[model samples]
Target: MTPLPIAAPLTIAIDGPAAAGKGTLAKRLAAHYGLPYLDTGLLYRAVGRLADEQGVDLDDAEAAGAVARALDAGAIDEAALRGREAGELASRVAAHPPVRAALEAFQRAFAADPRGAVLDGRDIGTVICPGARVKIFVTASAEVRARRRTDELAAKGRTVEYERILAEVRERDARDAGRAAAPLKPAADARLLDTSELDIETAFRAACAIVDQAPH
Candidate 1:
């Protein structure tokens, strides 16, 4: 007799503030489950970067929507979007209702991929993948998040100040949470993984435990 194939619809949705280690944890969980992974924020950054190239105002809903719909997720280059300038523009474009609607379909399609997927973003749990099998909202204090982001940038020789990063984090948090469309919040049933007191290893373990207990 031949061995049977086993399939599990394990979609993990992770949402958190910037530098809260959610992205890192999401990758680990994806690897553990042998699922595809997506950093959805990059989708917005790709649109923002293109908008900048075309000189389209990030706040122009019509133009932003058109640009976002015209873009493809496969074109996003993660290495190209690691910066504050692009992030700011992404946030601005993200605030537009049409822009979010334009990208929403792409995200949904990825989440429903046959192999399963783990998505990490500010609104993954609350909005993008609300029906995901496992939802984890990873977070940390502003100071702690700032420290992590600062260290990450320094490693790449960017040399930005901790204070500036802290301020930017706070501002971004406010913008994300206060936005009218799909705000950055955890689903009511989602589990919280605070990384303020936990390292990447500990956080990943907790996330794995959450997935383990999830009913297939």
Candidate 2:
């Protein structure tokens, strides 16, 4: 991979709520800069899916933590963690402190790479990589995010209701912000990007500008 124009150890943390485009933006930025990229949220999703498969109570902290501890992040079936049910399960499991603690080391180690990496998740900026050289908080209105998610699911041949998705989006926002462990919030120094009115290309350009302006 080609190195970024910036200096070494240029960790970039991108944080946001569901369907806000952080994942898409992070992938694009990672490609542009030739950095390894991680969607940290997938860690929780995988754990949640595994716990569910094992018939563990979704709200059981110990059970969820066990799943997280035993997780082989590389072996997670990404295809199975792509829908609303997986998202809800992930949110519940992620609320457990033990679950977060179990996954923290892996995320930090990835960020510690000398070649740098781009990580996107709810707490990437605030908890996982507070000292990252660049941080971005991507967000959009709940309605807009819900529409995006609904359209995405529809494209996949899944029938979904906009109202239901909107409610879920709001519910997730409240749960994420109110959670005791690593509650979702922007880092103090993170640049904010509201994609409610921006297309992917426009959002990508804005994110690129933010990274370009970071002190290298």
Candidate topping lDDT: 2
For candidate 2, what is the lDDT? 0.94
lDDT of 1 at 149: 82
TM-score of candidate 2 relative to the true fold: 0.95
Q: How many backbone clashes can be found in candidate 1? A: 0
Residue lDDT tens for model 2, 135-172: 99999999999999999999989999999999999999
Q: What is the TM-score of each predicted model, taking all chains together?
A: 0.93, 0.95
RMSD of each: 3.0, 3.7
lDDT of each: 0.87, 0.94
CA displacement after TM-score superposition, residue 197 of candidate 1 (Å):
1.4
Worst 10 residues of 1 by lDDT: 2-11
